[model samples]
Target: MQQLFKNYINTFRGLSKEIWWLALITLINRAGTMVIPFLSLYLKEDLHFTVSHVGWVMSAFGLGSVAGSWLGGKLTDMFGFYKIMIWSLLATGFLFIALQFINTFESICIGIFIVMMVADAFRPAMFVALNAYSKPENKIRSLTLIRLAINLGFSAGPAIGGLIITGLGYAGLFWVDGLTCIIATLVMINVLHPKKAKVLDEIKNEYPISAYKDGTFLIFLLAMALFGIVFLQYFSTITIYYKDIHSLSELQIGLILGLNGLLIFIFEMPLIKWLENTTYTKLKLMLFGVVLTGLSLLVLNLTSWSGILIAGMILMTIGEMIAFPFSNAFAVERAQKGNQGEYMALYSISFSIAHIFGHNAGLQMTYKFGFDITWYLVALVAFVCAIILYFLNKKLKTITN
Candidate 1:
């Protein structure tokens, strides 16, 4: 037992202090991620929006994310990750607070779009910062460490957010979300001083090419976007499904969502560590993970029993744990071939595109057809994407060999 505990601890051993600080900042920021998880609920219940209106608003959120990711990537490449990270966080803090004041349908859509634009800009810049702070060998583990912080915060956010909604209402969610961004910004400024950090020289590829010109990478991004679409349903229509179909309370829903994060927190790092030592290719692992994710959605259709909800969540969480970090590492590896900022931006933007379409499609399908149909459709998408990724992996290997 003691040896097992030590082995788990050793997985985190080689990461740099700056990476730890970055993880801490991510923890602080993500811990207050209360609003998005509950945004559909808030719109439907508090604002009394129709299902269609909710879909439109969520789509707007995705549109903003795409714009933000593009702008952030460009800016980070031009200006440097440190400046972009600081400004994005600071701006996002203010925007979240401002979002509370806008109540109408059009205004709220505009509000969410603006807020996400500023917020998601942080993503690519943070990735660049990870590149700067981490040693070459430690990049994947550093990414995993940051993801662990994110999951930990996610676990806490929903449970606390549910309580906050119960006590202080949805308005409280905005305030908490806003304040945490500000606090995270302050911590970043204080701890991760730009002057003290070590920025590694960009990896020089033998035949460097623009990320735009990379055909294989673009295909990979498409698969990522599809994965994002399937994964993001957890934040959107699935919440509504739990509420309307299963008749779960807000707290129960929050706890269930929190369970996804808690499981990732407990298992993901050690799992990644174990996988790192194995002979399995990252692409092969990702394919397996994607298959698991599809199964997770399919599991939901198997039974109406609430016990199945836990079963589905477990499958989805495991899939996420396996897929996301490796996918991130793959993107980073690709980014090193040319412009890191541009490549990473496109990677983030793929998910942004997913956000734009995924939520609306899920909601509209649920409204028109039903949750079961929506699950089947999304599961099909996941399975199809997995097949594409499999082919892409083979092509990549051929090129390398």
Candidate 2:
């Protein structure tokens, strides 16, 4: 136990000091997000909305995320991450808090969407700004640490959210989640400032993000959108599969999903070390993830064993860890120095698009097709994603090298 504890501390120590702030910020953000994982549940269970109405709410959130994705980079570039962040926290917090009062399905759906867009707008800004500030030597390490914080919060958030819902009910959970964001904003106010790094100047001095405008960035975004379609299926449709087919509880689902993020927390850095200095190879590695993910989905339909599901989740996590970092590294690596925020913002759009399809259309498709068909469809999507990346990899390699 002592040896294990020591090793754990040292793993974190391997990251740059800047990551400590990221870890803290991620925790605060995740804490604020306590409302997120259980949001669909809140809508269905508390507000008693029809499934279609729930879909609209999810759509609204996705729309907001899209807006944020487009604007986040420019805001970071213009106003700086600090100022925009301030606005994002307050906006999201109020939106979350406001949801507590709505009894109507339409109001809940439309209102939350607007709130989500406003709140989520701050996300990429934080990501890009921190990426801009950190030393290049630690880019992968820093990103890994950030992902770790997000997972840690993710791991904890649902369990806590459920507990709050159980005890104080959904409104209580919403209020708490909102407060958490408000607090994170306060801490962030100190972490970023009114005046700070001149991102444009830094780009000129170091790895220029602008150099990536050669079109590889657009290709990367295309692949990301495709991959995201497959990835988002986990949240939107998989839950129904577990509950309807396997009779799994919310706790069980949380544990299953948490496994993916947990594996990433443990192995992401070492994996990156093994793949060192080659973001282009991420395309191929992500294909392996695609297969594992496909396998994971298959396991759910093919078997009824609880242990088997857990095992499949572990494999899926490995695939996620493998693919996500490489994708991020490739995009950032190819970006022009000054345009890191813009690039990250553009990449974020893929996930937003994915979420939109995943929750809305993906859910409808899953409901109609069933798991056997859904898993197969998901696998086909993964294969297509791999194919797209393969062609992009060929071109990206030439440009990068």
Candidate 3:
């Protein structure tokens, strides 16, 4: 056991200090991620928006995310990751504050769109920064470390957010979230300057054609997008399910959802390390992750028992551990040296597309078809995604080998 623990630590030993600070920045930013988790609930409950209306607003956020991701990637390649990230973080802070004051449906929709656009632009820039800071060999482990930080903060965020919402209501959530962004931005500006100052100049001249022209990668994107649609339900429709169907309070729902992040935090790093030694390829593990995600949703519908709910959540978290980081590493591997931002941006766009399907379609389906059928539909989607990913991986492996 001691040796195993030591080996796990060794996996992280080669990574640079910048990677560690990046993880810290991620943790600080995510720790205040209270607003999005409960956005549907707030819109439905406080603003008296219908479920469909909530879905529309959320989809608007998704649309903005798509635009933001594409623009962020281009901007990162042009202006560099540092300025892009700093502006994204600070702009997101201001938007969050602005969102609190918007109560009308049209106004809130516009607010959500702008907020998401500004906030989500940070993602591609962050990934680009990660690529610049870490060595190629340490890439996967570095991404895992950052995800570990994210999940750890996620574990805390919603729990604290739940308490805040219960005591002070939704406005408090926005204020706290906004303040955290500012703090993260301050840290980035004052303490953590870029180690790879030449990254901008290095990649500036090596422009490639559009990612859409790459057929294999496009297929991979489609498969991953389907997986993302299913994976994102935990954020979108599941909250409503717990509230309406299970009659759980916000605090209980937050705690239950927080369990996913807690499990990921505890197990993901060690699991990634273990997988490194095993014969299983990253794609195979990701396939298993997708299958587990389907099973997680299926498991939830099997019974109304609380234990079953927790069990399903555990399975979903395990799926996340297996799939999400590896999928990212795969994208990074696929990119040409100078075009990492564009590839990562395309990957980000896939998840943004998922928000459209996962939120609008999910909520609409639940409203019309009920949770059982909706969940089964999502499960079937995951199963199909796994199959597609399997073939795609084999193709890539053959090409590389």
* RMSD vs true structure, all candidates: 1.2, 3.1, 2.0
Model 2: per-residue lDDT, tens digit, 76-149? 76776677778888777777888788778677667766776777678677676656655666666667677778
Question: Candidate 1: where are CA atoms >4 Å away?
Answer: 200-208
Better of 1 and 2 by lDDT: 1
Report lDDT (Cα) of residue 63, candidate 1: 97
- The lDDT of each candidate is 0.92, 0.70, 0.86
Find the number of clashing residue pairs for candidate 1: 0
lDDT score for residue 119 of model 1: 95
Per-residue CA lDDT of candidate 1, range 154-250, in tens?
9999999999999999999999999999999999999988889877534656765789999988999999999999999999998899999999988
Error of 1 at 273 (Å): 0.9
Off by over 4 Å in 3: 1-8, 195-209
- Candidate 3: lDDT of 222? 93
List TM-scores for all candidates, in order: 0.98, 0.89, 0.95
- Which run of 10 residues does model 3 get worst, by summed lDDT? 196-205
Each candidate structure's count of clashing pairs: 0, 10, 0
Supply candidate 3's per-residue lDDT for 284: 89
Off by over 4 Å in 2: 1-14, 194-201, 205-214, 277-280, 398-401
Candidate 3 global Cα RMSD: 2.0
